[model samples]
Target chain A: MRTKYLVGFLVIMAAIAYLAWGGLGKSLVYYVLPSEYADNPQKYQGKRVRLGGLVKEGSVQFNPKTLQLKFIITDGVVEIPVEHEGTPPELFKDNQGVVVEGKFAGKVFHGDNLLIKHSESYKPPQQGAKLKPEEVRKLLEEAK
Target chain B: MGNSKRKLTDSLSSFLLLVGFLVFLIGQYLAFKAPPDVQQGYLVRILYVHVGAAWTAYLAFIVAAVYAILYLWKQNPSYDRLSAASAEIGLLFMALTLFGGMMWARPTWGVYWTWEPKLTTSAILTAFYVGYFLLRQAIEDPEFRAKAAAAAAILGVVNIPINYMSVYWWRSIHQTATFDIVNRKLHMDPSMVLPMLIDLAAINILFVAFLRMKGAIAARAAAREEIYD
Candidate 1:
């Protein structure tokens, strides 16, 4: 009975280990960096994939009337133009780390989802930093 | 077991439950009263429950692993009961952690589920404990069942460290730990610290209370089974 149980336990553990290893292997590259995607554009072209990088400074363009937001995602070495629909998350800002989920269309990556990659730090608003009246109204409207 | 001892444990369990519930209420009030985050704003409030539940789940699994070791070392049936009870509670809190995380993720991450390292490892952790119970149910002989479960419980704990470290080890979308236990540093604002600490304490107290209640019930069930035999 002891030997039988030992063998059974080993078999189960092996199976679980295999399953876990497979899961880790597949998702190890959760989002492809801009440089990696730039290395082989054909590999990700037309394929739905997540592209992660910092938003390029002074590159954000949002049209409230069209609900279209455009930005350039950069890894400092390479840059990819991203066009996302819908309002950006509250944390979204210039030079913010973002992960855009979509496919490449020509040189532009059309993103259906935009996610803000926030830092581990959580803080209240700074003493000197203040939101403009319109900005506060916009934020309140978005919160609703 | 002495009848007086049993009565004492029952009263202790009741007292802990009452205290745990009261602390939980206070913790919720503090969580709402805490200031909003500069980035996430009101959404950051979700972390009070999400992180607390996740921490408690990890605690439960580790406690289960320790009890499993005791059962194996001394061949104690009571230890086995306690180990199983702890794992059951761990599973419950793990569900809460996963569900609460999704609720937090939808508005923040733009997706309810993603195949990131932290999430994948957590899913694996949940699966192992679930299999632990399934294995327990499969065995017919009580002694053999205890022996096998003890082995599995010891092995299952390997996932806890892996799950906890997944964010730091991998390039995942999930944020790193706000309360870095290893570095002994907190990354939260001053206003939020008290509420977070209160939530953590409340959940931990509730976990201990639940463990005692569950263990006592398990002991009673074992006693009844033996009486029938």
Candidate 2:
């Protein structure tokens, strides 16, 4: 009976190893965005993936040699340089929100397909919008 | 039911589990490294392990549900053991599912956790099974344990369909099933799927093998205690 346990434990340990190691190669998800891809291009080049973030105001650059590209993607915190080889979306411009698909090749987005996303539009208060100062004044008068 | 029968079950489970784990390792080696995908590169390789674990876990849950029903109907302790074993294993792989998911999510979705249907429903199922285990822990009576677990098993099984339909039923962060686990996609590339299927089958057999081993042990312990009394 203990043999069953010994065997089961060994087997499960092996299975756990297999489960974690069974992939053809390492497939850890990237916690960092384009900037990381740039900082460590060697680590991320030629990987298949989908990356999401906003487009930088003016960082899209296309290279002729490898159909390569350079752009900046920001998560509102950090901006990452992106590179791709394919044609970009119509709205894919600096400062536009975007998600890029493709692999990284040394500090470039190597984007194969560009998916353009627009920020949600909110209407500003009407031009004639008024604020009642009476409530504020009453509170002030009470304080006095 | 007999001692010898129980012993046979134990031997079989251990042996099978060993074999299953080894095969899974082989599948991973073949699918992951040497021949990187020419198109999408290493990222495409994630499909192999991710899909394998997902399918294997699903199979375990279905098996647990079936065994749960059988145990309830027949009042068989063996059935209860099988149901319990399957649930335990199912919970483990379900965890793997969540881990693998986050690994993929950061790269694909650009976020670690999302309230997506597949992720959310999977999380809920994980919680449900945890509750099942907790329920078992609180109850000392085998009959009551089996009854409560069975009821929970049936009710909890609904989450599987909910998980599958999440992308369709609601806008979710998860992608739709482009390549079903069984059906091989041409673009998916044979180099990848080959090891995946093997790993999946290996895991399946291993799960059953484990179910039998642990189940038999529990069954025997309960029986021996009753005999002593």
Candidate 3:
């Protein structure tokens, strides 16, 4: 009887230890919107974070040699430049909505990611100069 | 089956229980003191615990389904109880997953929760298990409850993979796996990998220990019912 009670106590202790450890960690989570980013720019400066918005057409610039790609991410209210290396996702294109994460420096993001959102027959279908479904499929298949 | 050996079983479980607690402490510290992330600085540390909990929860759900299947095959109450125990831990782990995910999201995604399919599926998975418990509560017959619970576990497996692959298939609010701990080319520094491994080990142990205790409690209760009936 005594042993059973003792074991239960130990289990409870372990659970507590886990929670306490998490609490003492380096930082906590912060939730907000894009407009918030513009409000207190300095508070979030130099920290790694993700920004979400639509890809701005004509804003993308690529230095093919160095693979230093640059583009603008916009929530309509704010537009921020993003730089990334390697290959962007197949669906990543102009006017496409995306979420990017990395660090912000010199008024631009050295982006480590580009997560594209494929809207399901939602709305904006780019007019003219954009790849249609067949061309898009062919492009992706060739890249692979 | 015999009371004479009850003391021994209880005592042995106590020893495993102690070891588990020690591992939990060391793991938590490792997670806390782990080095600043290469890019994210300190915010990346949240991944260690959050990922650990999420992983364990997924494992618990799978194990619960396995046990449920076994119960249905052999008509064993012990199997049902084991499934119940695993489901309970799975629920706890799923909660941890959501909390860790939300915390990570705020800094990274600029949103706490999204209507993304992955988050939605995860909510559904947790609800399924919570519903299992509710279903059990309404039934008085142990045999009937076991059958119903087993069926629920089997059906719930469909939601697990859906939660996992939701990001790939849908415009999910969740992010993809960032760094692979085992990728030789993209090796994480010791400060990062060490704590992650330690936490993983600790959580795995915790899962087992939880199962043992809950399983025993359920077993004893059923045994008592047998005597009364």
Candidate 4:
């Protein structure tokens, strides 16, 4: 009876292993920087990938009526234009680090999802150090 | 003396439950009253409960796994009872985490559920524990049931680390670790951290109370079974 139970357990484990192997293989997407992607855009084009970089300053444009968001992701060396449909995440902002998952096509990365990657360190800015509302308004106007 | 010990334990559990409830109310008040995030605004409030419940679920699962290993090693029925109690509470919190996450995600991520690694792994972990409970209920003989449940508990623990590290291990839409314990720093503002810490503490105390109550009930049921035999 003990041997019978051990065999059943082994069989169950084997089946689980088989399923996990296949699921992971099909779902795994590579995480790459903008510079790395720019170096060989054609090589990764049409394949699902996660690109991580800072959102370029003064590049964010959102049309609330259309629910369209356009931004340029930069790694200081290269910039990739990303167009996303739907509302951007709450934490998403200009000059913040972000990771976008989607495929590159037609000279633009079509992002289906946007995730704001906050800094690991928590350092609140000094009082009055943050950008003023007027300055933010000006920047958005300039971007438009 | 035996009756006195039981009375003491009952009083202790009740005290824990009352304290946990008061703490939860305070935490909720603070969470709602805290300043809205500059980026997420009011939506950021969900982080307090969502993150707290997720952390508590992980804690409960770890406790269950540890007790399961002890049961296997010592063949102690008490450890098995503790494992079951903790796992049941873990499942409850895990459900809360998933529900809170979905509600938070709908407005933030533009979708309720995605096939991302972190989300998928969490779902898998929840399902595995559900299976753990079903397995416990399926077996007839007490010894066979305990042995099978312990083995399942041990095996199911592999999913815990997988669920936690899924974000880093793969390209996921889910955010990375919010708190850097090794560095003693937070990824968000201190204002946000305060309420989250309160909720986390409150949920942990509540978990302890629930586990003790559940453990006592299981012990009594086992005692009754032995008497019948």
Q: Give the whole-model CA lDDT for all candidates, comma-separated.
A: 0.87, 0.65, 0.71, 0.81
lDDT over C-alpha atoms for residue A24 of model 3: 17
Candidate 4 lDDT tens digits, B136-179: 76666777888888888888888888888777788766777787
| TM-score of chain B alone in model 3 | 0.87
- What tens digits encode model 3's per-residue C-alpha lDDT throughout A18-114? 4234421211221223566788888768987767678888987766568778898887888887889956654567887777767778677777866
| Best model per DockQ | 1
Local error of candidate 2 at residue B25 (angstroms): 2.6
Which TM-score values does chain B get in all models?
A: 0.95, 0.86, 0.87, 0.93
TM-score of 3: 0.60
Candidate with top lDDT is 1
Q: Where is model 1 chain B poorest over a 10-residue stretch in terms of lDDT?
A: B1-10
lDDT of 3 at B156: 73
For model 1, report DockQ. 0.43
Better of 1 and 4 by DockQ: 1
lDDT of 4 by residue, A56-84 (tens): 99999999889999999999999999999
Q: In candidate 2, which residue ranges exceed 4 Å CA deviation? A: A1-144, B1-9, B37-40, B181-187, B227-229
Q: What is model 2's C-alpha RMSD?
A: 20.2
Q: Would you list the rank order by lDDT, best first?
A: 1, 4, 3, 2
